[model samples]
Target: MFENLKILRRAVKAVATKDPELRVQRFYLIQEPQVEFLDRSTHYMNVGFWDGDATTLDTAGEALARKLGEAAELRAGDTVLDAGFGYGDQDFLWLREREVGRITGLNITPHHVEAARARAEAEGVTDRLDFQLGSALSTSFEPESFDRVVALESAFHFHPRSAFFREAYRVLRPGGVLAVADIIPIDGATPRMAFKAGPLSFLKFSLPDENWHDGSTYAKELTEAGFADVTVESIREKVYEPWRQYMAGRVDDDEYRRKLGKALHKGVVRHWSGQDVMRQELDLLDYVIAVARKPE
Candidate 1:
């Protein structure tokens, strides 16, 4: 009961606060460094891209990263800026799989930076992976510094996300691509969804009101930020529904229960275990991969 009250207090404070960055950082601080469901040493923080026998959380997470990397057209000699990179798992994947020349990851959360840096050192890839404490919305990069900029599952927390778009536009070299795997509200969702998602999704997840919009508006924001050849595609079928099913299945699994341990007592865990409830909550969202390029 005390823990639940503490969680409720934090949720109320997050809702009342205007500092989105701080809210987002605090939101992530509460999450386990190793996501409870993943059951792997590698930590990934996203709704996985479920497709083609990618049944595990880690594999689907890698698939989503690969999808974003493909959208960015990652080349062998590219300098990439990963904005709001969580734990740098995708950076490691891209470095080895995509063979990107270098990756500079910027994140606001200190623990994430520390954890990612420790992982980089452990993997002996410190030279290629750079994780720094910074803000994506207001980076300090010079003009035309990177060949690609990507944000995986983290853009929605960026307050006034358009500022980050402008920042991405400014930092990328001419003709360079920008890609993001983002979550936005489904247009015309029912009021019950609106009410539930408002505090749970928006407040607890640090989603700002400005970031709540459909895919068309998302593309328009990139276009307005001086990106051309923009594409915002909804891949919800591959993202949300499958993820909910997987997680709902996990609720009854022994391994998952062992991992979560005492967290099972949390009200949120009970809420998540109900498949219909999870479906309704997830149905309110649209998962999209948005890609655009700076004009040459």
Candidate 2:
């Protein structure tokens, strides 16, 4: 609620900047269209490049699944759930690899579910993949329904992070695994780095105006929510250089490269007053992933 309050103030300020005749849909931290587009576009292109097994993992979603899947000894035939299944890449990979028996994906945005379904159809894995619109914080699924649940880089949009973890625990079977990858504040809840990173990153994270939390903070939240053996692995360095080069390589050689690149550049500048908000995190992970499990 604190975060949402801050965003409400910004929205009011923005309305002031405008004619004040039009009321922005500032309810629930919805970003201005331009900011949302830029953030999504950059994530799509950059993650697409880093995701080697994109048949299942999406180039448009987070890239840590492949690593975490391996780290957790996850393999084919398990029932998997992609909690915030944007682009359906992680589940897609699971489906294609036959790693999971079937994967149920839930996403808040209809647009993501639409694209994910289409991709599943095109890839001929429709039978093994299913996606629907729902909030990760309070999705509807029977208790003990899955063997593995993952929310890759999509957890931050879920405020009071505890709720999100609690929900994941609710639906997960005992001993089922839960994995989340997202940005957290390092030095308390400071908005400084976030403000500098600008709206592009903040919008992507659905950050409240601007808020940051350290990785440890999220780890603690996971534990509080009843996830056992919580672990936080920083994949920042491996991702930084590769992600930058990948973002840089988004243009040329592909179909929409020029158009998307141009749009991305303009969007970045519009939101952050610069076209390279992700530039600074080239050394450490812009964020980290937290993995935990429901006790058997």
For lDDT, the strongest prediction is: 1
List the candidate 1 regions with Cα displacement exceeding 4 Å: 1-13, 34-38, 188-205, 262-268
RMSD of 1: 2.6
Q: Among these predicted structures, which one has the highest TM-score?
A: 1
Candidate 2 on 1-296: residue-level lDDT in tens?
Answer: 44344544765554443221122213223443343343343223123324444321134243465665654446678877776666666676556554678888887666568878988888887777888877766766888888888876666655556777888899888998888766655555354334454433434334432225677776787888888989887766555555555444543225434444554444433443433555653322355767898998
Against the true structure, candidate 2 reaches a TM-score of: 0.70
**Model 2 stretches with alpha carbons more than 4 Å out:** 1-63, 192-194, 197-205, 209-211, 248-286
Candidates' C-alpha lDDT: 0.81, 0.59
State in Å the error of residue 13, model 1: 4.8
- Could you give candidate 1's per-residue lDDT for residues 1-296 as a string of tens digits? 65556666666665566677888777765534444435755578787899896787888898999999999999997999999998888999899988998999999999889989999999898888999999998887899999999999999888889999999999999999999999887782334224453224553347766887888889999999999999998899999888777766766777666765565345546556446655777777788999999999
Quote the lDDT for 8 in model 1: 64
Pairs that collide, model 1: none
